[model samples]
Target chain A: MSNHAFIVYKKEIKDMVRDRRMLIAAFGFALLMPVMMGVLYLVSKDSEAEARNTMLALSNIHQAPGLVAFMEKREIDVVEFEGNIVPEELPGKADALLFLPDNYGEMIKQGKVVIGRLYVDENTKLGIQRGREIGSAMDAYSSYVAGIRLLARGVPAAVASPIITSSYDLGNAGFFRQFMGNMILMMMLMAPFVGGLVVAVDTLAGERERHSMQPLLAQPVTARSVILGKLAMVSTFSIVSSLLSVTTLLIAISFIPAGTLPFAVYVNAHTVPLIFIQLIPFSILIAATQLFISIQVKSYKEGQSYISMFMMVPMFVSYLKIFGGEKLADFALFAPILAEMESLGSLFFTGEVSVSHMTSSILVSIIGILVLTWFTSRKLQSEVMLDAA
Target chain B: MIIVKDVAKAYGDVQAVKSVSFHADDAKITTLLGANGSGKTTTLRAISGLLHMDAGSVTVDGMIVADDPVKAQASLGVFPDSFGLYTRLTTREHLAYFGEFHGLSGTKLDAAITEVDKMLNLSEILDRRTEGFSQGQRMKVALARAILHRPSNIVLDEPTRGLDVMNIRLLRTILFDLRKEGRCVLLSSHVMAEVSALSDHVVMMAEGVVCAEGSPAELIARAGEVNLEEAFVKLTGQEDNGERKVA
Candidate 1:
């Protein structure tokens, strides 16, 4: 490195360390990941435990004997309530209240039946969903009773029920992984916004505010060296932050109980390394994007706002993929944050690795860095530096 | 020596500096005297390669400033009116950082630091961070960094703009010593007394153009005034009522 470039880098690092806010921000990010994940893990575990221990109340009025028998077999306490059940006690005393309305059996016999209402607290959506599962069991018992009654009348149950439909998920393990990978994808996408913003704002806008940019620009160093030095410092912070975040997430996952669901939370050792390998290019893209934004803005506050606005890009992309049911196209896998999200989803849910996808991601990040460097260099060469000075 | 040949700087349609030219030879303190918006700082910035000129060229040590900015910058040291010091760096670190930028290191860097420290009288606060330093101390530190490489050309824009009488005298004595070392010093200030006391050559500017150029005595004689201040007012076409105070 040139002496001027080395001095610039050393000074920047010194300033970053000395500034309490920067240190707090960098360390705070690292601290935030572990602490946040730990808290979330504990809260989730507590909630699951609470749910499992909860007792539910089932009320079947004019109910078929078979449905009643099934409830008894399942050990669900049947409470015969004529009027509205106590709303406040539903959450604490009962997980959910099952309400079987009048003439339910007659309606089933007529071959046209209405499902009973599952009374639950609106705030407890999870409890309501669980109540529906119990309701489905009751429906199965009702159907069995009606089928036996039809057989006794010399009419085939198949004749009465002419149409039958069933559904199955055709997607492989990769698709399942992608579904569960949303959270990781979202976090990985956020890496650029979080890491780049801090580095860029401190490197360019902060220097301008401090009135040190003039002397820095007046040095005999090339503009490229100046920018690269700044990018290296900021990228170091970002990469460290990303690694810490991923580690914290992994630690949190380790606390999850085995056999909690169909999928495993424990990532394979190889998977962890692969995710980190993919993150390298993603972090570079983030740092470059942030540096570009930081150099364009005149103040740290403006840089912060720009970063916040850019943060929305990843969030929007994730939402579009999830709720919008948008399939990830091959081309989308090359778009910076989008690529990381898709790659993370693949890695976590299916344990699948796409070398082509990884290569494309690397190329995209390189292009992003090049474009950002060009514009930043042009800005450095312009009168903007003088005005900033 | 530093030479500016017909330099003009324009920002959009507004010309900040208009075809102004002058030269500062070694062993002389040349002062650029002008009113507000008179393009004195613009001229200094152009010489420092901080601003690009629309026409003509600036040469320091026979190297064109705009064409070979790095070489020209290496040969010159610029000290603006307001010196900005890094709050996180100590006085010694600040000097060392700039010394490294000028390609001085190891024993040479240490010797340069020692020389600038003694010259600027900053040895007492060498280890202290500059966050709590007084304005005079900051100015001294800035001067120390600028002269660490001992460049042949020194450009100062209002170096004593804000200073106590004692500090101002101290800075003037330092500038006198710098001049004795056969270094070309380009100074810009509105203070008539300071300019008259220190400047060997005076270039008066008005509306971004050189209105008059000569020695302090020559300008005074040419303008038919008793001192350089009245001469500045006369050359720039300002009414001189003789009521302006000189500190």
Candidate 2:
């Protein structure tokens, strides 16, 4: 049985290799993630530059000299706006704006709550970070004023604040590493899902549509073996392409200008194999399910459309794991698609993947591969899948 | 020999093959002459174990297809109506793939490819990919792949549907050679001239069952017609030289 499957595998791989153009295209798409990572690094570096010299358009700076001094001390460039400048119009006009309402100094003396609007274009990374810095600086100024008020009332500054709260992050990885973790893992997850899509669909539905599957099925091999052969070929391509993409990402990460980020973003030799290992089972699952859906479709075009749409499922799962910053329920760790992504995240940020999480992920992926392969094999044997029959 | 006995199949509400039965003997070519949707492909599929029959049995070389489809398939070469050629694979590669599929390997696989290549005059195109191959070239590669393993039985569906006169003649010679080697060659075709010229036994099917089974001469006599074409139209209840009613 295995021998026949290997024969099928050899033929499929040969066919795929002969269609080098399609493979090259898939590889190109896989390389996009690494390319995107490089682009993001450049953008982040630019944003870092923007943060150091944050330029905020101030409409009423004369009313808040103390706030102006604090802004200058923090290296925030205070630019004078001569006309009415709206925060919503800040996209191409200015990075951010600080609007101090009229009578702001009188309200401070009267101890009335004064709402100073800090308008920022949240769309840009620099605008968001600079806005955060200005808010914290406002807090520092308010506390400094509170200390003076307490001294006038014959009280020590410690009377106003009893306890100082600070958090100790257990994870020692730098900000860039944590930030790139999602983007990198997202890229890794996408590598197999996107890379293996064409091969998986073409080997089955495309072959059937071209009338080649009939002769293939007529051979002395079992249907299960044929399915296995196709699955093995597609999974191998996906895994290899994902590994290459991961390697490319690592190399790309290494080329990132050192100190461009506050945190170090490194993909060591250990992480490379670990990332590849985490991605393999997911690749197998993707290949199997792709073939499963492709077999059910009538033609290559139909299969392509359906597989492209179906690819969004894994991507959605990966994105959810990346963006859903909340702690996940324990049961979620066993979910096949999300588990691999989360385990990869653990490996990157925490430097140690939880044993239970890894086991669950591996188990779910293996089980998913088996179940999908079984269904695909059953479909391959059915006459509905064999148009020539 | 390939024997199909009372094989009946239905797809949803449509009864495709209702009690179809026939036997193709060794060392002879059997032709299934039918119009469109006459269950010719369905019967072949049943014999190849590609489709399970609702009722009845099919056996290839004493092995029941349902019980031992792999073993039965090993002894039979099926060239479906569609040529089913991989455009990217060269003619030699196509032969090697099927040769390996039938358990041929190493020198045995290489020798089989060379022999089939010589017999089919595929030497000129063996190294060329099949993407731009003509219909005749595609048919030759598909046929060579089917027979590379020297199966005892060969089932071909619509083998001469789109062939030029020269290619048809070449196919005739190949079919004769297979028969002479004691291989059972069962084929389905709509072309009466080729059927009458090549088939030693003709199975006339109409509306999912065998309407008549005999030599071309016998069928012509049974229909009281001068030629096999009129006989086929008459046996299937369709008027000659008129629009064929949809089955």
Candidate 3:
């Protein structure tokens, strides 16, 4: 690189440091990730606790003794009533209402099961789901009750059962950790949009808007040098934000008591380096993508809009993964945001990643960076930068 | 010295410059006179290696600039019509930036800075950032940067477009000094007075082609006009003094 290239790079970095808005935006993004993760963790923890302690209102109290006994045994607080449950009294009164018809026991006794109704508001879905778990326990108890009655009449209980089976998870130690890790990794992928957007926009589009790009482009330096310099600055901010987000997540998980749930939520010291290694390429790809968008637009606002649209792609991909539980294939590992999520998910939950998968994911990310850099360089070569739109 | 041999540039279907040819010798100011969209700026950009010519070549100091732009551009200084300045950089830093591009560093960089600053009369605002500079100040700073490396050839496109009358005179004086230094200075302007006053050689362009070329007095005498502007209008066969009417 020539001194001109270095001067360009130094000038870009200096400008970024001087601009209060860009600095705040970068730090704001870093701070935002931790705060968001912390807020989400708090919300999830609170909801889980609330769900476990939820109370249910029961109607038609006299219909089933086994279910009542099962609820008491499981420490489920149930209030029995004779009529319809009032919606107005639900808040602070019960988490949900279970309406058992008068003929429910009769239907079951006659070997004809009837469907039970659960009345719940939107806010009570989690609690209601937990409350409904009592029904499963009741089913086992009712079968036991029927077997006892059969024994009283000298019939074998085993003859009344069709089959018996037990379930055991075949997943490894890191399975649960990997699942939680995927969520963290997804959050890290999102860091680039939050962290890299402001810097990238300010570097290219902002310069153009300020009318400073012409002199820079006209300098004796090559376009590649300019792009590399800007990309370096953007990636620096992105990596910082990603690391901060991961640290905040790990700290939040540490506050949770051990053995509280199925998944290992804590961030282990051993995994930090590996996670960082995996994340660097992901951040590079995201930074390059945002830079490409910045280069295409004319002003900072347009660059911001372009980056916002680009950000939606990764977010939508993450949403699909979370809600759809899409299975990852070899080919899917080459997809940008999806690949990051999958690799991270595997790294966290399974603690074992196939070498081929890791190689392909990194390859795809590097390829994305290369393609975006090429595009930005090409734009730098155009008269569009010199010609105001 | 600079040489243009049958240079042409196009944008898709529109040909901006059509088989244009001219030569600019050292120790003289060569001004390109034309109406709006007459390919003056396009020709200057082509010579600066900023635009690719569809046909022909631009050679600066015997080095082909357009075909191998990096090498070609290294030997020339270009001051665009509406150049941008880094708002945060002090005038000295701006000069230093361009000076470094031409590989001037250490004592050499310092000497270049001192010389350009003294010549451009930018010593007053050398330490202050350029964020608050007036149009004329900015233009002076840009000119200083263009000549910081003391390149063999200098190409300026409408360098005095927005300057005040006093600054315009100052710029003309500087151009004269550059000509005396035996450096090839190619300037494009619509202002016929400045062109007539400073140019030793004038090339009149019309519709992407050079219609006339000679000394200012010679062109004026040949076109049977007393002033350069009348000679330009006569040579190009266009009226309307190239001025914008305020509403």
Candidate 4:
């Protein structure tokens, strides 16, 4: 770095540190974002687990002993329903309600259909999934009875059921797990952006609004030196906030009960350092991008508007990786934010090294910083700079 | 010493400064006297290497501003049209920041600040943030920031605009002292009495061009007027404008 650039860097850092608003903005994202997301993950995980643990309240249970026994064998805890005939909501601990008629057994023995209604809450996704599972189990019991009836009639049961198929989930992660997992990665990537945003806008656009750019540019320093100094200052905030976010999340993860999070988190010492290593240059790249955006506008408010818009780039890329990652080609998936997610996902959940993705992220980050810094520095010399509003 | 040879600049289709030319020699106070919108600020900015001239060149201490702005800027200390103080920084800190840009640091930097503080009576606000500083205190810091590096040429645009009478007198003394040290001092203002009192040579600008130039007495004599203000009105033909302020 040039001496002039270093001087600018030091002054900007000191200036930023003394600003209470900047400090709050920088630390707030680092401290609160991860904890909030972690809490959300825990809630989703518990709800999913609750959905899987089926509890059914069966009405007229005495007339359906075989059905009740079948449900108990299938691990659906069955309880007697004694109060309201038609409850608006599920009874205290029941995931669903199974209604049976008084002549249910008699109809079965007479070979007539026994009609019943299964009321399951469809308010939440978890509710819908639980309802589907309960309906599937009831259908299985009905098929079992028909097979038995067929065998007693001297007809081959195999004739009734020609195809035999079973299912096994290929992936261990559940629906809520995958969603929260993608969310966590997005939060981690966004932490640095939120951290540096205030400082980035203030450094260039704020200076211009204050008309300080005129005096600073009047000095002997080159625009390159001035921009480099600002870029370094913004990167300082970005790196600190991002690293703090990772560390806070690591500590938060350590405190959670084992196997509680819906998704896997492999935050050991090795992966933690690797995650930091990936983020340092990536945070710098984000800093350059933000500074580049901030310089295009002439006022602090205007710069904030543009830089906030630039923030959407990360969010858009993160969402693409989360939802469309599988459908996206490898080249698209290995872009900046996507590449970072791919590497961090492994370091975070799978405990496998994604070296190619990591290398690509770092290389792309370096190239991006250089290109953005070049453009931003050139913009500093534009004639409009001389006549700020 | 600074020289502007037929410098021209424009914004869009509107010409801000057109074919302006002048010389500021060492050991002399040369003031650009003009009415508002007379392009004084643009001329000062061109000398400071802050703008790219459309048609001509600016050279400070034998270095061309357009060809090598840094070298040209190193030889010039500029007080821009606005004080542009950083409200978060102290007077001393502001001095150090601009001082460092000029390659001043450590004991040398400290000595420069101490010296400037003594000259500008900045001891009271040296360590205080500039957030609530009075106009006079802000002017002191801005002037100190400009001259801390001891450049060969000092250029100020309306430096005394918001200062009280006392601060203006103090600034006048400093400009005279700088001239005594053989530094070229170029400044712009329309206050007739101030221009008459401070300038050894005056370049009168009207509508982006030099309307008149010479010593105050010489211009007054040339325009067949009794006072410098009368000479200004008769020379620039600003008699019909409502914005002329001779005071």
Pick the TM-score winner.
4
What does candidate 3's lDDT look like per residue over A1-389, in tens digits? 44555666676777667778777776675566656655655555444455455566778767877677777776777777657645654545566677887788898677565666766654533554555565554566667767776787799887776775544658554333343445566777887677888989888888888776766665666788888888888887788777776666666567767765446542456556777888888888888888888988888898888888887887777766665654655576557777677666666655666456567778988888898889889988887776654
User: In candidate 1, how many Å is residue A99 off?
Assistant: 3.8
Runs of candidate 4 exceeding 4 Å displacement: A47-52, A82-86, A156-159, A162-164, B242-247
Q: Which sequence of candidate numbers ranks them by DockQ, best first?
A: 4, 2, 1, 3
TM-score winner between 2 and 3, please give it: 2
Q: How would you encode candidate 4's per-residue C-alpha lDDT over B159-240 as one tens digit per residue?
A: 8898899999999999999999999999999999999999999999987888889999999999999999999988877766
User: What TM-score is obtained for chain B in each of the predicted models?
Assistant: 0.95, 0.95, 0.95, 0.96
lDDT of 1: 0.76
Ranking by TM-score: 4, 1, 2, 3
lDDT of 4 by residue, A215-284 (tens): 9999999999999999999999999999988888888888888866667777777788899999999999
My TM-score estimates for the predictions, one after another, are 0.89, 0.88, 0.87, 0.96
Which runs of model 2 end up more than 4 angstroms from their true locations?
A48-125, A135-179, A262-267, B233-247
User: Tens digits of per-residue lDDT for model 3 on B21-89?
Assistant: 999999989999988899998899888777767899988888887657778777788898775887878
Candidates' C-alpha lDDT: 0.76, 0.82, 0.77, 0.88
DockQ value of candidate 3: 0.47
What is the Cα-based TM-score of model 4? 0.96
> Candidate 1 residues B1-247, lDDT tens each?
9998999998888898988899999999999998878889889988988886889999898999889887788888878655768888899898888788788989999999899888888878899999989889989988887888998988898999878998999999989999999999999988999999999999998878898999999999999999888889888875554332332
Q: Is candidate 1 or candidate 3 better by lDDT?
A: 3
Candidate 3's docking class is acceptable
Per-residue accuracy of model 2 over B72-131 as CA lDDT, tens digit each: 999999998888888888888888888987889999998898888888999889999999
